[model samples]
Every structure is written in structure tokens, then in C-alpha cells.
Target chain A: MIVAAAKPWEEIMASLHGMHKVLVVGCGGCVAVCLAGGEKEAGIMASTLRMQRKLQGEPVETEEITLTRQCDPEYVRELGKKLEGVDGILSLACGVGVQVIAEHYPNIWVAPALNTKFAGATLEHGSWEERCGLCGDCVLGQTGGICPIIRCAKSLLNGPCGGSQDGKCEVKPNECAWNLIYERMGRLGRLNQLLEVAEAKDWSQGRDGGPRRVVREDVKLDD
Target chain B: MSNRDFAPKIVAFCCYYCAYSAADLAGSLRLQYPPTVRLIEQPCSGKIDIRLLLQAFEAGADGVYVAGCLEGDCHFLQGNIRAKKRVNAAKKILDKIGVGGERLEMFNLSGSMGPRFAAIATEMTERILRLGPSPLSTADKGEEGKAE
Candidate 1:
């Protein structure tokens, strides 16, 4: 899931400056599971905005709503009725959700409440760690299910860059991804796979190819 | 209200297993404590979340505190511990929102500690009195809200 954190209070406040009424939108998808932007968070944001603005003597009114998933058109369009008198939208969704709302509305002012961090997995109840780089490549099978592109600080294709100390990455406090991969491969009796030299990844398959879109002809709906 | 006559509105979220019972004991003993504290009983301190804590302040609470079982004595094991972390998180938000983190606190005590509960009430009341009213509270009271 994509993990994100709320932006600073001042920045969020500045974005909605001069707006008397605003709609705060939360996504019930990845941001919800990550505990960043969800129904509860939307309430907190709305309450804080109302209280803080009132305290500041601006007194902006806010309404909170959490869409099923802000990334999809179906859920984004559901917000139309609620936008009647809203001066702006404070989106608590990820970057994709914020863009979807902006692209759909066109004329409404939209601002992101969260700084989209990374494609990550929950390490524990409140801890999240980046796990996928979204490199548009499949090498997890060869690397023993850990994507070195993200887990490794250097994104080394072949093996550890030799800066690893006590299984921890030299560049960061996290465990060396190559070290984890080596151990995982060893435990699976597939250590022999590490002997082959890996070639450089295809840059065109990733962000270098520009914005990505997937169209499934089989699931196409006649418009 | 004038500075000298300021009475802080303190909200205490007391866990049933410990703090709530302790408050009850204090009442039975007729111990003297500030009447400013408004108690809300909870199943466990862990039941308290950031939203609830912030809402208390948003609702004009000058100060708020969470009272739970003494560290390891929580009826549900780590409820008090979880509450402690949440209180800290809320404190950070409070500080960020210019309300001052000193306005919120977390206390750990067993159900047998009636005197201790009274002491905490006095201590919290004194602390809030020293800090004056919450900026949010002052806003509600129609004063120019300013956090000291």
C-alpha cells in the first residue's frame, strides 16, 4: 500500500486561506489502512481546521467526507453533490487521489493534506517500511521475494555494495536489503541463484517512460 | 475571567479498572480535590484516541489528562502503555497547534491509590492554573486567543 504522512499544519492552513467553507476529503483505500488519511483522520483534520481557524479569528467552516477510494472516478464523482457551496477541497488522499479530484473538478481549488511517501508495507501497528520501488520490473523471484530496488539504498542489482555492517545498511539505519536477500535465499536452498551477474534494469519500463496507464481490453466498458 | 480568578476546565479520562475506581474511593473518603476536573470513565485508557483527546480541547477544555492503571497493572495488559503513547502523540499535536503540550498529561496509578488521585487532581489544577486557559478555550470565551 502507499504510505503517507500529513503535511505541516501551517502549510495546510495556508492552502485554505480566505476560504470560508471547505470540504475535507479522506480516502478509504491505502491511506486508510496506513492510518494517515481515513475517515477518522478526516474528522481530526476538519475539527482541527475549524478550531484553529476559529481561534485565529478566521472561522472557516469545514465538512468531512471519506470516499470509498479517491483514486477511482466512481468514488470521486460521488463528491459532486457535496461540493455545492464548498469554496475548496482539502484532500486527505494520496497524490493520485488529489489529482483525480482536481482533474475531475477542473474549476475547484484542491490541496493535498498528505505528502505521499512510498509504496510500503506495515511493519507493525504503527510502523511502515518502504518495500516496493515500482520499477516496473520483476526480480523478486530471483532476489528471494525482497525487491532490492527499494530495500537497498543503492538499488544494487547484483549484490551488496560491501558497505553493509552487521547486516545494517551503511547509508541508512535499516537492515541491508542484500544481506536479507542472501539469508532468505540460503534458507530456501537457492543460494546458487546469486552467482549470476544481473544486467542493468530497463529505464524505459519505469517513470522514465512518462505517466503510466493500464488498459484492459477484456474489461472495457462501452462508453 | 480575570487572570487571578481563572478556573481551568480540566477533563480527565479515567480508566474503569484503576483511575475511575480511585476517583470513587476519593469521593467516598470525602478527600478534598479540585471540582474543576470533569471525569469520563473508559473501559481502558487504550480506548482513548487522538481524535477524542483533541475534541476535548476543541470543546473548550483548558486542560486534559488520561488516568490509567499503574504501568504493568492494566486490566487489559498494555492498554495503559498504549494510552501513554497516544497521550504523547496528542501532546505533540497540541504543541503544534499552539495550545502548548503542557496542557495535556498522562498518569499511572492503581485502583488503591485514592490519595494519589486527589494529589493528581490538585497537581493538574495547579499546572493548568499556572498555564492559564487554553488558547482554544480563550477563543470560545471570546478573548483574543493567545498561547503563552
Candidate 2:
């Protein structure tokens, strides 16, 4: 899931300085699952903004709404009816969700309330770590299911690089991904497979090429 | 309002297993305490969240405090501990928004501590009195130096 964190209060306030009425939108997608830009967080942000403004003697108004998934056009469309009298929008979704709303409403001012972090998973309650680099390639079949592209500090395909010490990554406090892969492969009696040197990864499949998109004629609906 | 005439509104969230019972005991004993505090009973101090604490201030509370069971004596094992962390989080937020974190606090005491309960009420009232009304409260009265 995509994990995100709320931006500083001062930053958010500064962006909406001239707005009298604002609509705070929450996404019920990856951000909701990670506990960042969910409905409850959106409500809290709106309340905090109003209270801060009231204290400042300006007294701004704020309304809260949570979309099923802000990344989807159908849910983003739901925001159209609520935009009446709203001078600004504070989207509590990930970057993708924010862009979708901005793309839909070209006239309304849109601001993001979160800093999209990474494709990650919750390691524990209130703790998240990046798990996928989104390199646009899969190598888990050869690496014992451990994603070296993200888990390893360096995206080394064949590794246990010199920085690996005592099964820990010297660059981080985490257990070295290469070490874990080595152990798992050994247990599977597939250690012999590691003898082959891997070729360089294809950079074109990733962001190295411009923005990427997918098209599936089978799933497309006639306009 | 003048300092002497100002009556700060203090909200106290009391856990039923401890602080609430202590307040009840204080009432039965006819102990004297400030009238500034308004009590709201909760199933456990753990039920308290950052939103509730902030809402109290947003509703014009001059000061707010959470009274939970003594450390290691919570009825639900860790409710008081959780409440303590939340209080700290809310305090940081209050400070950030210029509301003064000193306006909010958390205390731990057993259900048998009636005198202690009265002491806390007196302490919180005095502290709030020294701090004066919250910026939100002052803003409501349309006073100057609102919340710069």
C-alpha cells in the first residue's frame, strides 16, 4: 500500500491562507489502511484548522468528506456537488488521489495535506517501512522471495555486498536483505542457483523512461 | 475580564475505575474543591483520545485534564498508560497552535484517594488561573491579543 504522512500544520495553513471556506477530503484507499489520510484524520485536520483560524480572529469555515477512493474518477466525481461555496480543497489522500481531484476540477484550488512516502506495508501498529521500489520488474523468483530492490539498501541483484556485516545492513539498522535471501535459498537447497551472475537490470522499464502508463483494450469501455 | 473576575472553564475526564470514584468519595466527604472543574466520566482513561482533548479546548475550555488510575494500578492494565501518552501528544499540539501546553495535564491516583482528587482539582484550577483564559475562549469574547 502507499504510505503517507501529514504535512506540517504551518505549511497546510499557509497554503489555505486566503481561503474562507475549504473542503477537506479523505481517501479510503491505501492511505486509509495505513492510517494516514483516512476519514478520521481528515476530520481532525478540519477541526484543527477551524480552531486555529478562530483563535487568530479570522474564523474560517471547513467541511469534511471522505471518498470511497479518491484515485478513482467515480469517487472524485462525488466531490462536485460539495464544492459549492468552497474556495479551496485540502485533500488528505496520497499524491495520486490528489492529482486525480486536481485533474477533475481545474477551476477549484486543490492542496495536498500529506507527503506521499512510498509503496510500503505496516510493520506493526503505527510503524511502516518501504517494501517495494516499484522498479517495474519482479526478481523474487530468483531471490528467495525477498525483494532486494527495496529491502536491500543498494538494489544489488547478486549481493551480500561488502557492507553486509553480521547479517545486518551496514547502511541501516535492518537485517540485510541479501543475508535473509541467502539463508532462505540455502534452506530450499537452491544455493547452487546463486552461482550464476545476474545481468544488469533494464532501466527503461522503470521511471528512467518518462511517466509510464498501461492500456488494456479488453478492459476499456467505449466512450 | 479582570484576573480576579475571570472564571476559567476546566474539563476533567475521569476514569470510572479510579478518578470518578475518587471524585464521588470527595463529594460524600464534603471536601472543598474549586468549582472550575467540570467532570465527565469515562469507562477508562484509555478511551481518551487527542481529538476529545482538542475538542474540549475548541469548545472554549480554558484548561483540561485527564485523571486516570495510578501507574501499574489501572483496571484495564494499560489504559492509564495509553491516556498518558495521548495527553502528551495533545500537549504538543496545543503548544504548536499557541494554546499553551501548560493548560492540559494528566494525573494518576487510586480510587481511594479522595483527598488527592481534591488536591488535583485545586492544583489545576490554580494553574489555569495563572495562565488565564485560553486563546479560543478569549477570541469568543472578542478580546484583543486573541491568538497571534
Query: Candidate 1: lDDT over CA atoms?
Result: 0.92
Chain B TM, cand. 1: 0.93
Candidate 2: TM of chain A?
Answer: 0.97
* Candidate 1 regions with alpha-carbon error over 4 angstroms: B141-148
Candidate 1 docking band: medium
Error of 1 at B77 (Å): 0.8
Model 1 clash number:
0
Backbone clash count for every predicted candidate, in the order shown: 0, 0
Give the TM-score (0 to 1) of chain B in model 2.
Answer: 0.95
